[model samples]
Target: MTLALHRHGPDGVPLVLLHGFPLDARMWDDVVAELPGLPVVTVDAPGFGASPRPDDVARAVGRSAEPALETYADAVAAALHEAGVDRAVVAGLSMGGYAVLALAERHRGLLAGVGLLDTKATADDDAARANRLTVAAAAESAGAAAVAPMLTQVLGATTQAERPEVVERMRSWLAAAPPVGIAWAQRAMAARPDRLFTLEDLAVPALVLRGAEDGSAPQEAASTMSAALTDAEVVVVPRAGHMSAVEAPGPVAAALRGLYERCAQGSVG
Candidate 1:
């Protein structure tokens, strides 16, 4: 869907970074700044950041009945095509992780490696799905301000206590997000399928990372994903939460750099 992108670095295996739900590509600024001399791309998924809305995405995907995650993945593929990237190390955070799995399922050949950060491989339970719909309806009715509290829910206690500025930055980002976009994301995430099998069948190097204090993606979730992968490494970043890339950019970037090197060398196993 001609998604907006932030691109940098030279010719090589591109690293595509997907931000979490309700957040734009700017979330990767800290992490991107740490990695030098590597081709990188950060995308604004449909209905988020500067990208088009759900209607525009549906038109770009040429299917109205398809799942939103798959459509978002298609948009990523289109973005990669525009950038002349045939293969890449795709890394996603939270909702972005969900999109990464969908991309693997739909566009496996394009992935050189996969990075799943602070996300789960399971689908939403009945209650969680219902809650997401409820939140979506609220966003549609009341706008982004209504969902501002979600920032507190997702950020770790350490961040809230020691990194007030980061919390404020996140609040600003959430508050400025388009309400329609937020609602669309909620519905899309609610409808995402369980993707554990995708992890089990992963043919590329896989890295599963979670913030030690991340409530959204707990340790157990990371273990489950690790167990399913044939070649996977599980890492827990201390003093971080759902937004590990933001809270612990150094460690997160280090892990990503290692993954990229491993993928580039074809030495994942």
Candidate 2:
């Protein structure tokens, strides 16, 4: 798939980051800046941002017509391989969080640990699946402008005046996303396997984080996963929402730095 990537940091244990749905790697700009001396890679998922959307959904999904998250995970692992990163810490936001868990499942040896930010390891409920389809239909019908308001509301409530910039960023990202890509993501998420078992199934270090204000992921999910994981940590970034990388980059970066260092040092018990 060859997703477009933005690289930062130095030649240390590589850290791969996947941005949330409807957003590209730009969402991690601030967080990436916080990792000063480690090799960092941020990728745009296929069909979003600068990456090309797959023309063959059936092929990607394997007869179900649903897009596969593994396909995107494969693309990410391929990108890391192309850059000579055999193993590293993997982190993701929202849909990217799904990618991280899939990566862990498919290539546990290739990951030092995982950071799941504002993302759940569970599969989508029926209501969530229905909502995604509904939104996808609307995105196809109304284009980027129609979804901008909801994007703003879902991200977080800044001051009334601060709303404009948030909406503008979302508008730009959505406008740039191909409609096919949006639809494909919706189907992919709907069909994704529940990865809560990934925590117990593998001993890889993990950190689950969410915004204090994030209604999407909620604190209960993080607590549940953290309690279940053999070596998992939970963090709540105050005053942040779904987009903590943007809303509170400092804590997110700090969390990444600590997670990476622990993984690098073999500190996870």
Tell me, by lDDT, which candidate is best. 1
* Model number with the top TM-score: 1
The residue pairs in collision within model 1 are none
Error of 1 at 49 (Å): 1.2
The Cα error of candidate 1 at residue 249, in Å, is 0.8
Q: TM-score of the candidate numbered 1?
A: 0.96
Worst 10-residue lDDT window, candidate 2 = 56-65
Q: Which pairs of residues collide in model 2? A: none
Per-residue lDDT of candidate 2, residues 1-269 (tens digit): 36677779776667789998777788888788887887888888878777766544234433333477888887777767777777878899989999988887877777788888998888888999888888778767876544565565556665124656655766666667667677777778888988888777667778899988888988887887787788777889977778888777889999988888778678431
